[model samples]
Structure formats: C-alpha cells, structure tokens
Target: MNQFESLSRRAIQAPESGIVAVVNHGRLKAGLIPLWAGEGDEKTPDFIARPAAEALLAGETFYTWQRGIPELRQALADYHGRLFGRQLPLDAFCVTGSGMQAIKIAIEAVVNPGDEVIQITPAWPNFAAALGMSGGISVAAPLDYVEGSWSLDPDRLAAAITPKTRAIFFNSPSNPTGWTATPEDLTAVLELARKHGLWIIADEIYTRFFYAGGRAPSFMDIMDEDDRIIFVNTFSKNWSMTGWRVGWIVAPPSIIQVLENSVQYQTSGVPQFMQKGALAALEYGDAYLETQITKASAARDLFCDALTGTNRVVTQKPDGAFYAFFRIDGISDTKAAAIDIVDRVGVGLAPGTAFDKGGETFFRACFLRRLDHIEDAAGRLADYISSL
Candidate 1:
C-alpha cells in the first residue's frame, strides 16, 4: 500500500480543475491559440497598474488590515452603490486574495463536515473541489438551456434542497455558460433559502460583462443586509487583474468576522500594494470596462457568426460573461473531441464534462480574444465539426 494512502480521502478523491485537465492533455505546444481558461486577454490598465508600482516604490509592502484596507472596502461599497443603489455598509466586505480564495473563504465560513451545498451548474470546477476539502458535498442543480440560452429554473433549484442542505452558490453572468440570472429568478432562490434557512453564496465575478441592467442584478440587490448571503467578487474579471490576485466577499458582519479569523490561516492579508492598485481600479477602471464591454459584445457577435458556418452546433449569443458553451452532434465524449481539436486545429478548448455531466456533449470556448482570433478559432472548430 502507498504511504500517502492515509491522507484525507476527500482530498485524494477530489478532481483536479478541468482547466488543468485540458492543459495536461496537451496545451503546452507552440502556436496553439489558447481559449480554454476563463480570463480576458487585456492587460491591467495603466491607471490601475501604475499605482501598484507607485505603492511598491513607496514601500507599502507591509501587511495591512485583516479584512482589507479601509479605502479598498469603501471603494467597493461605493461601486456597489453606483451599480445597485444599495450602499452596502463597510462591515459587509472582506477582501480575500482572489475570487477563488473568496470562494474558499465562503466555503470555510459556512460549510460543516458532511453538510451539503447546492451549486447551480455548470459551475467552476474549483467550487466542487473546495467543498470537498471541507468534507462538504457539492450538489449540482443544472441550468435549463432549453431555448438556446441559459436560465435557472427556480423550481428545479428549490426542489434540490434537502434537510442537510446548508447553502446555495451561483455564478451569473456565469462562467462557461454566459447566463445571467434575472432579478425574479434570484428572488425565488432567495425565498427558498429563507424557507430552508440556507446561506446564499453569489459569485459575481463577471457581473460587469453582463449585457443588460448596467451591471447584473445581484444577490445584494434583493437581499436584506442581514440575510445569510455572501457575494464573491474580483478585480480579476472587471479590472483585468487576474495575476494580481485580489477579490472580496460581501456578507453579513458575522460572516465577515468569521472570514477575518479564517483568513489568518489561509492568507493573513492581501498585499498592501496590491490593495492600493485595487483602490485605483475602483476609482478609474470604469472607462476601461465600458470600452471592453463594447469590444466584448462585438467579439461575441463575431464568434457566433463564425460558429454559424458550422451546422453541427447550436448556441445563442451569450447575454453576459465571456464564454460560449455549445453542444455538438456526434460527439458523445467531449473530452475526446477537445483532444482532437487541440491536436488537429491547434486550438485549445474545454470539454463540457469538466463543468458537469449535464455538459458532456458540449464544449466551452472563451471569446475573450481579438475578434479576428475568435473568428479564426471558430472557423477551425467548424472545420473540425464538419470533418466529424
């Protein structure tokens, strides 16, 4: 028997991230146009970047507040007010290392061993793995993509709730499937949460990419300040600061307090200089986002147009977020298709199985590329489908 066999069973059993699975399958080759992971190609704007350099030069390297610098938290509070007209109190925020870390923090704060958390799928793979680390179950309630676009069926989600269900987490303008849950849909889920006394975790990393309502209507929009809901947001998506690794959670004071303590174990504080740049992101990143939205909308159109040349797949234009999730005929195993595309077309895409079994015949492509590149990738994908 292996010496490491005594390690935590859940840790060993948990799957590696699907994004990594694509990479492991062969993505390191030269000249492969990569669109597998969910991030934009844009650089962090100079307005945000310069300040972090300035802060670093100004010797702001030391640790700061455990929750986050007051300036950054308040900046986020103001930003939320500008979007939702709900001026969140400063007490409701906790700036974690990244949106992923914020997810980890929320999973830690709310889930108990052997408890269940219902996730709206297809979800980011890390969500399930994180829950497993805490010995919590990640039960998926898949989205209904019936009319070519993605939507949450409130009744389906409500039915997924069990006596052991402790929480529900959703991402809208979701990754992999650019579905933005409507305000009515959110309210119904919130009602379910209230009925079951379940925590609500909202991952709003892509809220800015939403096609309507300025920003996607959020959990905070319909929630009472004291409700058991936490919002996971990031500078990564909207501000283009993925590598900078900064994100925050919006929750009740009790949850924030718990996070502040738990963070001391995971990461005591986000870098002080990085928080300064985050301050700049909130102050000045709006214009960059507007420009990006315009470009992203065009990119989305170009991607859909190119995909139209292929008769094998069906997808509506994504209403929000940056991905195009579509199903293909004749491909019962999407991972094999993903591998074939990578080998033949020199384009890397994620198999649907990475997201959930419900997505097995589907594949996800990030359109966060130059419109020309997106078109080229789509053409290649179309050729592959035609060959099949």
Candidate 2:
C-alpha cells in the first residue's frame, strides 16, 4: 500500500470549498467579476492599518503572549461589553489566529474523537472541516426556506440531539446566506443546549454587518454568565481587516484555559502589530466601519433590485452579512452552474452544495464590492439565469 494512502483518504475526502476554491481555480482568467468570498472588496481602514505599519517600522515584531496581548484582550472585552451591555471578564477571552482558528480551538477544547456535533446548514464550510480535524463527526441540521427567508426548526434541531452530541456550531449574519438568527431562535438553541448539556459554539464574525437594522441581536444578548456558550467574533468583517487574522472566543473561565493551552501549541500568539491594530480598531475604527456598512447596505439593495423579476432566481432580502443566498429553481448542478456563470456571464458566485448537502439547488452572491460592480454583476447574473 502507498504510505500516503491514508492522507488521501483523510484530505481528499474532504468537501470542496464552494466559492473560495472556485475563485481560486478561475483566478482572473475566468473572466468572472468575482464576488465569491465572504470578505468585502475594500482594504483595511487607514486608522486600523496605520498603527500596524508604524509598529512594523519600529521593529516590534517579536512574540508577545500566547493567549493575546492584554491590551487587545481588554479592548475586545470592552467591545463585547459595549455591544451586549454586559461586562465580559478579560480572563474569559482568548485570542486566536482568525475567527476560523477560534472555532477550531473551541472545538478542540470540548469535542473528543467520535463525539457528535450538530452544525446548522448553509453554514461556512470551514466549520465542518474544523470539527472533522478534531475527530468529531458532523451532523447537519438544515434550515427551512420560507417566504423568501431561511429559518431553523427548533423541534428538528432539538430532536437531533443525542447523549453523544458534544456541541452545535451556529453562525449569525451567517456566511453564504445572510441569515441572522432571531432572538427566539437563539433562545431556543440555548435551551436545547441546556437540556442536553451540550456546548454552543456561536460564530458571530459577521455580527456588525447587519443591513436590515442597525445591529444584529447576538446570543450574548440573552445569555447569562452561567450559560454554556462560546461566542466567537473577529475584527475582520467590521474593520475590513480580513488579512490581519485577529479573532477571539468568549467562554466560561473553565474552557478558557483549554483554549489558552490549545492556542499555545497551535500558534504562540497573534502578532504584536496585528494585536495593536485590533486595539486601534476597537478604539477608533467606528466611523470608518459605519461608512463601509452604509456602502454594503446599498450594494445589497442594488443586488436585490436587480434580481426582482428574474424568473429562475429566488432570493430573500438578507438581514445581515454581505451575501445573498438564492435558489436556482431548476438547476441541480450548482458546481457546474457556478462554473458556467463565470465562463459565460462573467459573474462569480458560490455553489450552495459547499455549505451543506441541502444546498445543491442554491447559490450565494457576495455584495461587498463597489456599488457599480455589484449592480453590474447582478445584471449579469440575471442575464445568465434568463439564458438558462
């Protein structure tokens, strides 16, 4: 047998990344006006990046703390407090390489090999891989689409719980589909966790990108100090610092130590310059973030308007995030559909199957580009659907 056979089974068997991999394969040659990733097409704000550049200039690139620099942790704690109206202790917060890493660290802390974890469908595909890497089996609980929106069925999710279920991963202002969990939805999930004694890993990376209202409600809003919830968030979306790789997890003090130790081996710490940049963002990046939010909201509206009368497409007005997830009524081959659109219509999007098995008939469009580009892409997408 080949020595690398196991590697092929483990890595090759992994699910394909819907949009990211497609975009990578297509590159600029695809002639697709790319909107396949979750990040905005804007660069990090000057107020956030300037300090990091200055720090680099000062030659302060050495390692700091394993968990995080105290200043950055404190800033994150303060930001959490401001958003949720409660004081989150610095000791309960641990920083990681990115929001993605935060999820992996949290999963590693709680899940053992063969433990079952439930993930909501139409989720960020990376979540599943993170759980798999930790030797946990992923159980998908799909959301139902109703009246141009997506929602979770609490009873179905509750029923999926088993004694071996260790955790459930949830994303709000969710990636691919801009589905923001409502207050009731969060409460119900938390209640299930309480009943089953399971962990709730909430990814709130896109929390600040809400478009329907000023702010998206968080699980933290309703959670108490005693709740078994680990809230993951990052400065990536709001501060336009996707490349900075600064994110944090808020858990009870019990799991914080596990996360701290896990990250110590995985990555010593987030870079000092990046930590300083994150602190500056928390302190002074609000105005710039607000401006970007306005632009994102406008782009979302433009896309929605463009798809209004398209026959084969059905999309809900997203409440948060920059994505517009829609069903291609008769298209079953989302991967081929995505590739076809890129080659023929010059618009790039993610196939729904990347998010979950139930996503085969769906497609996701990112609206985080310039308004004109968004309008143009939407028109191109409409034309493609019409041709189909």
Candidate 3:
C-alpha cells in the first residue's frame, strides 16, 4: 500500500482546514487587507526579543529540563498566582512547544481510546481534531445566541455526558464567537464535572487579552486544587509571541509527570532561548500587550459600527477577545461565503462551519489588524453586503 493509504484511518479522515487554508491558497488578493488569522499584525516586543537574543549569544541553545527552564516555570507560577490570587507551585506547570501542544498533551494524558469528550461548540476547530487524534470521540455542546451574545445551556451540556464521557474541553474569551463565560457559567460547568467525575481541560489562551474589565472569569478561580482541571495558556496572543512557540500546562502533579514524560518522547523540550524569551515577556511585556489590546478594542468598535444596519448581518459587540462573529442573512454555505468574501471583497474571514456544524451562516472577522486595515476591510465588506 502507498504511504498515504497506509496511514491510520483516523488521520486520513481528519477535518479539512477552514479559513486559514483559504488564505494560504492566495484566495485573498495580495495587498487586499487580510484579517482572517487569530494573531495581531505586530512583532514581539524588544524586551522579549533582546533577552532571547542574549541567551542565544551566550550559547543557551541546548535542551535544558524536559519540563522547561526552572526560571521560566517559576515565572509562570508567579504570574498564575498573581492572576488568580492563589499560590501555584512551579512543579504544577509544564512547558510545551505551543499552546496547541499543551492541549494535545493534556488530552493524551487524560483520555483513553474510545473515551467520550464533550467540547463547547463554536469552538476553535482544531480542538475537535486534537481530541479525535487522541482516540476520543467528540460530543459538541453548542452555545445559544441570544441578543447578540452566546451562552451555554448547562442542562444540555450535562445531558450530553455519558459514562464514557471522560472530559469537557472549554475555551474562553472564545474564538470565532468572542464570548467570555461568566463566573456563574463556569461554576455550573464545574459542578457538572464534579458530579460526573469528569476532567476539565480549559483553554485560556486569550485570557490576557480580555477587553472587558481587563479580566475574565477563569476555571482556575472555581476549581479546587484536587479537581481534574487542566489549564492551558500561551504567550502567543497576549505577548504577540505566536512565533515563539512557548506555552504551558497547569495540572495536578500526577498529570505534570505524564506531560513531562510525553514531552521527553514527543519533542524533548522547547528551546532554551525561547523559554528565556517567555520569561522576559512575562516580566516586561505587559505595557506592549496593553497597547495592542487597546488598538484591538478600537478596531472591534469600528468594525462593529461599520457592519451595523447592514441587511441580514447580525453581530455581537465582543465582551472580550478581538473577533467579530456574524451571521449573514440567507447564506447557508459559510465556507463559500467566506471564500467569496476573500475573492470578491478582498476581505478574508474564517467560516463559521469551520468552528462547528451549527455555524453554517456565521463567519469570524479578526480585529487585530491595523486601524487603517480595519477601516479598509470594513468598507469592502459593507460594499459587498450592499451589492448582495
């Protein structure tokens, strides 16, 4: 058999790439103003890069600890403590190649073959793929859109759990939707997990970018030390460190060991210089991130205003994060609509169907571009919708 066909069936049947793949294929014309990706169009702050460069100059290129550099882990622990107002030890955290890898390792550590995993829908599309790759079945619990806001139906979510259900994957300051779960919602989900003895894998990558009150409720606030909760976050979004590939996992000591062993087997360790860069980011990159958040918030406002009163287009002003998820009237094929937007309007966006089955009419526009780019893209989108 050919190598392609000889691969595992599960690997072969994985879902196709959605919006990112479209952008990669040059669907959007060059210089047309693109904002489809989740990251901002900003470089890493000098405070972060200088230290990493220094480390490299000092010949800190070799692999260090399998878990991560001690100083970086300690910085993460301190940062977590400051954010949550609780002391989290350095031993409770493990560094991975990226936030994506952190999620993969967490799932691998907790899920066995055929175990059922519940995921909050309108989620990051890759979450389902990660679970499936770990041999887990994904059960999507979709959020209800009301008054331009997305909310989880706790009862529906609980009902979806079966004895085979081993975990629930949650993302907040969610992708595509830009909805931040309230404390009450988190508490309700935690209660359900506690009752069912299910694990919780909370993806908080966008936690630091919250536009509302500068903070969003987290599973860490409600979870007990012994609860089966794994918190995964990265320096990617907040610090403009997407290319740095430094993310972390916070879990119980047992799971930490599992992740350590997995890191050793899967990729050995994140680069030592990158770990140092992350440490510098955590210590001195706050002001730079704050400026980016302010710009994103302005872009969010401008884009939402531009799209308002357009026929058959409905959007919610995001409480946190920088995405504007909107539904197009009478448009059922989100993938086609997204491609059309790029091809005709020169504005790239992620298709709703990429996030979930229920998102067929929805599409996500990232607001992390420059203010001028946002204005230009908004004009193109307005013109396109008007013509339609």
Candidate 4:
C-alpha cells in the first residue's frame, strides 16, 4: 500500500478546515479586513504581556506543575469566585495548553473508543474533529434556528443521547453562532445530564463577552458540588491573548489528577513563563477585559446593523460572543461566496461549512475589532450582499 493509505483511518479521515481554506486564499491579499478567525484584532495588552516577557527573561522556563502552578491555580480560583460567586478548591483547576487542549483532555478522561459525544451544532468544528481523533463519535443536537436567532431544545438534546453516549459537549456564547444559553436552558440540560448520568463538557470561553448587562449564564450558576460537569475556558478572548495558548479546566476535584495526567503526556504542562503571564491576567486584567467587552459590544451593534440594513442578509445582533453569523439572501454556497467576498471586497469571513451541520449556508464574522474597521468591513459586505 502507498504511504498515504498506510496511515491510520482516524488520521486520514480528519477533515480539512473550511475556514482555513478561505483564509489561506486571502491571507496575503491587500487591504483585507480579515475576520475569518475566532479572535479579536487586538494584541495582548502590555499589562499581561510584560509579565510573561519579564518572567521569560528572568529564566522561569523550567518544566512546572502539570496541574498548573499553585499561584496560578489559586488565581483561577479567585477569579472564579469573583465571577461565579462560588469558592472552588484549587484541586478543581487544571491548566491546559489551550482551550482546545482542555476539551481534548476532558474527552480523553471520559470517552473510550467507539463511545459517542453529543454536541450542539452548528459548533466550532474543532471539538468534533478532536473528538473523532480520539476515536469518539460526535452526534449533533442542532439548535433551532428561527428568525436569525439560535436556541437549544432540551428534548432534542436528550434524544441525541444513546446508550453509547458518554458526554454532551456544550458551548454557550458559542464561537460561530453566539448562542448563549439561558438560565432555564442551563437547568434543563443539567437535569438531562443528571438523568442520563452523562458528563457535561462545558466550553464557556466567551462568558465575559455577553452584552446582556453582565456575563452570560453559566453552568456554575446552577450546578451542584458533585455535578458531572467540566468547564473549559481560555484567556484568549478576555485578554486578547489568542497567541498565548493558555486555558484552564474546572472539574470535580476527583478528576483533576486524571486530567493532569493527560496534560503530562500531551504538552508536559504549559511553559512556566506563560503561566506567570496567565496569572497576571487573572489577578490584574479585569479592567482590561471589561474594556474589551465594551469594544465588542459596540462593534457587534455596528456590524450587525450594517448587514441588516442591506435587506438581503438574515442576522441578528448576537446575544453574547463577538461573532455575527448571518446568511446572505441569494447565497447558498457560503464557501464559494466567502472566497468571492475576500477576493472582490477585501473582507475575510469564515464560511459556515467550517462550523459543521446546520450552518452550511451561513457566514461568521468576528466583530471584536476597531469601530472604523467594523464599519468599513460591514459596508463592503453590505455592498456585496446587495450585488448578490
């Protein structure tokens, strides 16, 4: 057999990222207002970056605790206390290389080969892809899409759980769709998990980006001490530290060591200097994060309004995250349209095909950018939609 055919089926079957394909096509294009990626246009603030630089320069690069440094874990606890109004033990926190890694470790800790994970669709494709790589099947429990709003249906979610299902992967304030779960929704899902004795892998990375007065409703707001829930969060969105690759998990104290063991095998813990910076973000970056939320809120309104004004796009200002996921009136092939939008209008958008099922005809734009850029990109997109 050929070398390509000799590789494992799982490795060979992994799909190419549809978003990255569009990005690769237009990355070097001139004057492109790129919003295809799930990150803001801002750099990591000096307050957060400086500490890491200083720590690196001071030779803090040694291999450290797999469960994260004690100070950083304590800071994570304090940060959670401030946000969730709960005091969790330090053992409940295990730092991973990224939010993506946290999800993988959570999957590994619970799922065995041939098991299933029921995920809400249209999801950030990485979770399903990562789950597949770990020999887990991802069954879709698609959200109901009506009048440009996305919402969960608890009965549908429960129906997706089969005997082979080990967990439900939930991402609220979702990446591509900005579908934030309500308090009632949280309670419903939690009850289902309780009934099914299934684990809940909570991806609440965008909780702070909620535009509804305070943070988005979280599982922490409702879960009991012994609930079968694991929260995976990242420092990327809050502090514009996308490049830092730092994320943490909050699981039952019973599973912290097990998750840390996965960390030991995968990355052997995050860099010590980077943990120092993450510690700084947790301890001193609240004001900075608030400013970012404010900026995203403004950009969301401007961008969504502009697209809506076209009268040819179906979208609403998303309730939480920084994305504006919309469908153009005449565009059924979002992948082709994404390329055309990038090549013709110099605006980068992620096609919905990247976001898995139930998102095939939509497009996702990251609106956490400068107001002027948002305005410019919105105008260009509106014009393109009008032409379509």
- Most accurate candidate by TM-score: 4
The runs of at least 3 residues in candidate 3 whose Cα sits more than 4 Å from the true structure, single-residue gaps closed, are none
What lDDT tens digits, residue by residue, belong to model 3 across residues 258-288? 8899899988999898888999988877688
Please count the clashing residue pairs in each candidate, in the order shown.
Answer: 0, 0, 0, 0
TM-score of each: 0.96, 0.96, 0.97, 0.99
Name the runs in model 4 displaced over 4 angstroms. none
Every model's Cα RMSD, please?
1.4, 1.6, 1.4, 0.8
Clashing pairs in 1: none
**How do all the candidates rank in terms of TM-score, highest first?**
4, 3, 1, 2
lDDT of each: 0.85, 0.83, 0.85, 0.93
Which digits, one per residue and each the tens of the lDDT, describe model 4 over residues 257-316?
A: 899999999999999999999999999999999899999999999999898898888788
The reply for model 1, stretches above 4 Å from the true place, is none
- Candidate 3 TM-score to native: 0.97
Error of 3 at 71 (Å): 0.5
The collision pairs in model 3 are none
Q: What is the lDDT of residue 351 in candidate 3?
A: 79
Number of the predicted model whose lDDT against the real structure is largest: 4
lDDT of 1 by residue, 22-50 (tens): 77776577778788878778888889999
TM-score winner, 2 or 3 = 3
